[model samples]
Target: MSFLFNSYPLARAALFSMDAEKAHDLTLSALQKAYDCSLTRGLLAAHPQLPCTLMGLSLRNPVGLAAGLDKNGAHIDALGNLGFGFVEVGTVTPKAQPGNPRPRMFRLPRAQCLINRMGFNNHGLDAFIANVRKSQWRSQGGILGLNIGKNAATPIDNAVDDYLLGLEGVYAHADYITVNISSPNTANLRNLQGRDALSALLSPLQEKRKMLEDQYGRRVPLAIKIAPDLTTEEIDVIANLLPQHGIDGVIATNTTLARDAVQGLPYANEAGGLSGPPVHALSLAVISRLREQLGAGYPIIGVGGIATGRQAQEKIAAGANAVQLYTGLIYQGPALVQQCVNALR
Candidate 1:
């Protein structure tokens, strides 16, 4: 293991002593400093080049830093230095807003889980795009997916407009764009997953993508991020709808609202989507069903509860063409990315 990985427990212990959200902020700042000093780059092991294609884009490896880890794209270069084959940022909205009230993030170390209701808090599209353009990640052949969501104040019925706006804003800059309809923290966001509502949503986004592709002379692929708390029928509806709507890929899960895996653990009763080790099986089950329904050769990026190289491999086995991680990075450090890439190789 790299020194960062072996020494991560002490660093994590220090960070875990603070409020979870504050620790997250401080961690990003620290990474920014580390990037400037060109320090943490050496902390990563040799990232085995395990190239794979996802949604018409080539990736250096199948392991990616999931959205939300660098929601504004500010820390992207720093994170990319940690050896992720790709990095997806955002859930950024068309406009910025202070998300829910304070104390929205809770950690349950006993269960190695997190419950957060951070509600798409971000610096909006312009700032997000500027951050993206500042990065050399794509120039280095690193894949980037820009994740988008609606404004917190947007009405659920009129959500399609926000998504269309998001598509237009991010299309030119992204290797792929993720239509995030799955975050449980967003009010009624998951409702967009309904059969007719999803059709209504994807229709306009697809139409807009056609126009944008014509104008930009490039077709940026779009993927939908789904929630893990779905019934089998709901999963089937999404699987059928995405391909029909011209969406090129699917991100198997976001976070889970179900707390069965963490019952009796502290913060288990928190009101928000739950993630981490507890989500692994639920996420795997969703991936399996999505693969069966979407059929072979379709791109599926599995995420949730992956903290080890073996867990990452398990996701690939469950039908994910590639895999992403967020909470795992928090608990296991950046070395997990190298482990996953090596495992996939």
Candidate 2:
């Protein structure tokens, strides 16, 4: 384990020093190279024992590489080889496009957090599926969920089309599919989470799910990814609606707009959602609330602010069936993944 860090620490630090977006691109390229060289797969096998199951999908473990890390399916094989039990790719849209402008992503090292308004940038559904098809990654005997979203140009009223389009494209390839309605970077996207709007958005999708199952001869679990910024009432409303819509699960809490954890730090006032340590408390609260409303039987994916085993354990204790990490990986490096799996054991 120390050998991996000793061999790659300098490179990782250099990558992290660049602009976060650039660093992300560089990391993707590096992973692709690692996959081709067969280094990443070996690393995954050599790392920790991270094998677990959720939502009827058998994962090598519960610790997963979260969405937004590989916005497109470009590095699916590469990242899958990096010791994650699962790798969720994309906050994909129906159309391929570059997301928000330069300097859109900021790093808060002091607080071990990140602030980004990355606007669901990806190669779109077509490119996303094509990339996934081209990849040799198969979740190392686990699950690979595709996280889908709407286009930035798509209005809240017509957002259903965008999400549905994504679902149609990736449903066959995904072990499960996540409906991303929580990103604060997209204008008015979160409005769809309201009771009436959620019903409108989800009812039709449920109808389509039935049709898809009939047509495809299989059931694809649909999970909703929501924000941590919602009120208790809003959480209750969503919990009440889940079973009604046949929603399979919930990914509790996307990035937050809160700045309390990174308070007074440079870039603390950036205009994107904040992630990492700052979001941990709120995310756990939202998870607990949803758990309370939905009962213990429902599945929830706990995200936000997880940088350590203890933090991951807190999410599980708070009622999350699984935990994901992005900002934590940024701060602690790949060794964090091993630590999390070992701690869980």
Candidate 3:
């Protein structure tokens, strides 16, 4: 692995220097091509006996690949082999979109961070489910979670309809569904975090979940993905409101807007959400606070700036049932996954 990455550092540098969104497209295409071959898949598979369970779904390990990396489920088979306990695909919308304009993603390698306002650009629900359906790789005992959201044009007042549209399409394929109400890119979308709005958003979704249970002959858990930029008051509100809506779990942190850690770097002031080392402290703080309010047994998926076994252990100690990595993978490569899993064990 060292030899492989070392030789390509210059190539990787050139890719990073290009347009961020376009580079992502090229990277995904390359991965898909590599994974289409049997040899690469075999190389990426995890060892046996690495299983962990959360929210009724058994995972191959506790470490997972967070959302935004595979926006449309196009590379599930390829990525599944990299040994993630779980892989979350999409922040899929009720309708397809082109997302925000060019240069919407930026890399802060010095800080091991990424800032993106890709605006949930993805193929619509049908295409998303179709891609997921085509993937041949399922975790040996691992789980798959689908993160759902509203279309960029969907009015905040009617966000429930958009979420319900996604739930209808993805419920059958996912081990669990995440309600993404925290992304800072959409106009006023975070307003759904308010009391009445959150209730309006979740109440109908829970009803749809019940219907899905009846149709599928089983229950599927539902979780909410939050931002790391909230205040103590906002966190308290979520802890109080979650149980009321039968929320199955919480994904504590998507990305952050703060620049404290990435200050003085190029692209540091980019208009998007940042995720990486800069976010480590804030994300951990949110997890700790949530644990304090929600108490024991509230399932939390800790994500943000986790790159080492010690970092993963810290999140677990802070009350995360499972942990996820995005930026860390960008900085450390696939081997980081196994390293952290081994360390946790």
Candidate 4:
């Protein structure tokens, strides 16, 4: 069998022919069917194990699937079979939402880029936890990170409540929980990154985490996802505050609002977050700056525009403890996982 069950070039050609979001849904559905029929992990290429630890969590490899790929955790077993060391899912909100209008996701094959304004459209928390319960991925021992975000209708000031609710629901199930305050699709969501705002948010969250740790008997690490569009002073402020508030780690970036790298390209002017090759340098810049401020031993998961093993190595070279892929996987295929682990090891 080939690395990805079928040659990815063929699969990509087929998928790329359809509307971006529809193709996304079709792919996941087919994978779920493949998994249900017991094709399971064997249907996908097996990545070599490159053991490492991150924020006290042991991973078989450091290459992981970034969030927004499987928003509801419905395809965990199928995706987990593809050989990611960890699979992070969702940006799921408290209520089911339809997200932004049609054509929300766009591809820029020219630069291997994607622009999306997907506004956290996901099944509600209850349904999400149910999907988590149904997943067989955890039995295989790879780590799982559950990414959570606030609903669009929720007032900005009240966002902490939504995050708190997310923590309460996913805390017991997650190997680590990612607090998403960085997605540009949601209104004023990025405002949560401000000094006073971050302080306010983390204080309650860390306090709640302490309570949950005592209750669940496991202390799931908490990571805040930030945007690549931050200022130097803003980055420094967050770096200092993380340790102070007991935030365990930081996912160096979500996506970029700047289209500097994709100017004049179709969808380059789309009103959404830009991800892929264009965001690679921006993500690396944030990761490097974060490392300089956070110093060694602080966990950072570098992601954005990593389409090759060399770029994956570059993230580590820039001080990332591990790396993740979203747009890269869309364009480069599952083979990128093993390639990255092989390179990292």
Candidate 5:
């Protein structure tokens, strides 16, 4: 643990010097190699007190690696070894897409935030499923969540088709499926959160889920990832709709378009969702509101700007059943996972 903790500054310095996306890719590749060599598995610490259950899935801990970090499900085993109790991969679409062009990811070191317009760029559902099938983590009892989204080329009216396709493809392999209707990057994706469109989208997916449960002989939970920018009324409306649609859980946020927190900082004007410390308060507010509206027993997975043990505890205090990390991992390293789990315990 000391070696892992002590060495990150040098590693992060090297990564910070490179392009953000390239550094991300290189880091994933290196982590994969480390896991393949069985080096990281022993280095990671596990807390017995961290176990918890949510959405009927038995997680070894409440700390999870959020979606967008491993968008294609390509590094599940490597990431799983980082001591996260669960790992979510993808904002994957039914078809392959290149996402936004290069320089699409920017780092705001001063704010401990990131702004990305990656646009759900992934290698389509088939490849994504294949990668999941190839991962050793599935057999190791790691809880895996697959987040599904519509293709960028698919018109908003036809969005259900892409999600249905993605659901069909990853259903058997995932512990849960996240229907992502909240990404600000995919043009007009957030519009699906409106009352009429949300109902139209979730209704058929709920119906299809029943059929899939029977076919697969298992009931994999379905969760919805929502945006943090929604109004109180909008949050209340969606909160009411979740139980009505039989959705299993709600991931409190994706990212934010608001810039007040990062004002006057570099990349503050970049046109993408802002994450990290800038989103902590807003995400917490959404979680608290959702918990109030959904009532006790509804699962809420809190995310956004959790960089310390106290922040992780705050998410739980705000009524999250579980919590996840992404931007925090960038600034704090893998030790942060252990810290949060210990804090929760």
Candidate 6:
């Protein structure tokens, strides 16, 4: 564990020197190899105080690795070993697609942020399910959140079909599933957050979920991941709809399209969602508003710009039942997971 903490600076330096997307690929490859060799097990010291429960799932800690980091479930065990209580993978679609073109991911080192328009480039549900089945963490009953989305080619009006397909495919394998309709990279995807669209999307999915529960003999929870760029009125509408739809939880924020916080920085004008410190305040604001509308019992998984222990604590204070990380891992290294867990304790 100490070795992991001590060695990351040099590792990060090498990664930071390369193209952001390439660096990400290399990191995933290395992590995969480490897991294959069983070298990642116990690589971090576990914090006992981090235990909690959300959406009926028993999390070993409140800190989790966010979706988009694993897009596929390929590295769940390896990531789980890094001290996150849970690991979410995928914004996986029903079919395999290449996603947006190259150089789609950027790093704004000055703001400790990243901008990406990767779309939902995943190896389709078949490959994703295979990876999920291969994961040792899943075998061990570690909480796994499978995030689902529509294919880029799927029209917005017919988007429900794609989501329904996603639901049917991953339902049995996931501990909970997240309907991701807020990524800015996907065209018109955020429109699903509107009142009519949101209701239309969730109502049928909720019906299917009940049928799935009867088939599987367990009621796997469903959470919706929303964007941070929403207006207060938009938040109010969503808050009202969630419980009405019988949704089990909400992940407050995907990434933001707004770049106000990173103005003047390189890649600040990139056409994608901006994450890291720039998103911290926006995410907290959304969570605070959602907390106010949803009352005390609804589960909210807050995620966005959580780069430090204090920020993680602040998210909880703002009413998140648990929190997740992605860009923070890029700048702060894996130790951030334990740092957050310790702070939450």
Local accuracy by lDDT, each model? 0.89, 0.85, 0.85, 0.91, 0.92, 0.92
TM-score of each: 0.97, 0.96, 0.95, 0.98, 0.98, 0.98
Model 1 regions more than 4 Å off: 39-46
- What is candidate 2's lDDT per residue for 191-249, written digit by digit as tens? 98999999998998888888888988899899999999999999999999988999999
- Alpha carbon lDDT at 128, candidate 3: 96
How does candidate 6 fare on TM-score?
0.98
Q: Model 1, poorest ten-residue lDDT window?
A: 38-47
Candidate 1 on 1-345: residue-level lDDT in tens? 376667878999999999999999999998788677744556543455888888988888889889987888898888888878888999899998888898999998887888999999999999999999999889988888999999989999989889988999988889999999999988899999999999999998989999999999999999999999899999999999999998899998899988888899888998999999988999999999999999998999999999889999999999999999999888888777878887877
Candidate 2 whole-model C-alpha lDDT, 0 to 1: 0.85
Residue ranges of candidate 4 with Cα displaced over 4 Å? 1-6, 39-41
- Select the stronger candidate by lDDT from 3 and 6: 6
Candidate 2: misplaced stretches above 4 Å? Answer: 6-9, 39-47
**Whose TM-score is higher: candidate 1's or candidate 3's?**
1
Candidate 5, residues 133-182, lDDT tens digits: the string is: 99977688889999999998999999999999989999999999999999
Off by over 4 Å in 3: 1-11
How far is each candidate from the true structure, as Cα RMSD in Å?
1.3, 1.6, 1.8, 1.2, 1.1, 1.1
Worst 10 residues of 5 by lDDT: 40-49
- Candidate 5 stretches greater than 4 Å from native: 44-49
lDDT per residue for candidate 3 within 75-107, as digits (tens), equals: 987777777888899989988998998779888
Clashing pairs in 4: none
Tens-digit per-residue lDDT, 1-345, candidate 4: 355544778889999999999999998998777667755546664766989999999998999999999999999878888889999999889889989988899999998989899999999899999999888788779789999999999999999999999999999889999999999999999999999999999999999999999999989999999999999999999999999999999997898999888889987899999999878898899999999999999999999989999999999999999999999888878888888998898
